[model samples]
Target: MGLWTVAAMTAGAVGAVALVPVALGAVGFTSAGIAAGSWAASMMSSAAAANGGGVAAGSLVAVLQSAGAAGISTATTAGLASAGAGVGAVAGRLIK
Candidate 1:
């Protein structure tokens, strides 16, 4: 493809990747904790129920909660970036 196409794809990828944290926070997954009555709270409740009154370590709920309480790890960031890049590439092709 052209340089502009590549640039657009790269920009899209970066933008999508950057939005991950913001989106997570928007859904009540913040550094402090999951907000009461928020989507995150609901997920936690479901997870706790499924796991016998406790969220299991390494489970999806626990992992997301950890990420929210702290921040996504380098590996998670890389994985998100890769997924974003794939999405960007697909979108760019569709737009063209």
Candidate 2:
């Protein structure tokens, strides 16, 4: 895949990982785990964006985050992740 493809994948993965904390938190797993996991994911995305590799990342993140915000359940995170990866893969072709 091209660079953009990788960026999108990375972004999607970051967004998916971001959900882990929010998911566990909803399940009553509120503790250091949520804080730690969220921090890690956020830091990674921040770094990517700072490095100018966040276009695809942003695309993936936007899709997954929007999906979740639209009320898609964690029950669908896995499926969403797959879909997001596919989106990332095609992002280069679609956007360029």
lDDT of 2 by residue, 1-96 (tens): 678878887676667656754664553334333233454356446656776965354654444444434546666766768766776677755655
Name the candidate that leads on TM-score. Answer: 1
Question: How far is 62's C-alpha from truth in model 1 (Å)?
Answer: 0.6
Model 1 lDDT per residue over 1-96, tens place: 766567667877688668878888988888989989899999999999998999899988787778888887888888877777777777777777
Quantify all predictions' global Cα lDDT against the true fold.
0.82, 0.57
Model 1 CA lDDT for position 60: 81
Instruction: Give candidate 2's whole-model lDDT.
Output: 0.57
TM-score of model number 2: 0.33
Give the worst 10-residue stretch by lDDT in candidate 1.
2-11
TM-score of each: 0.87, 0.33
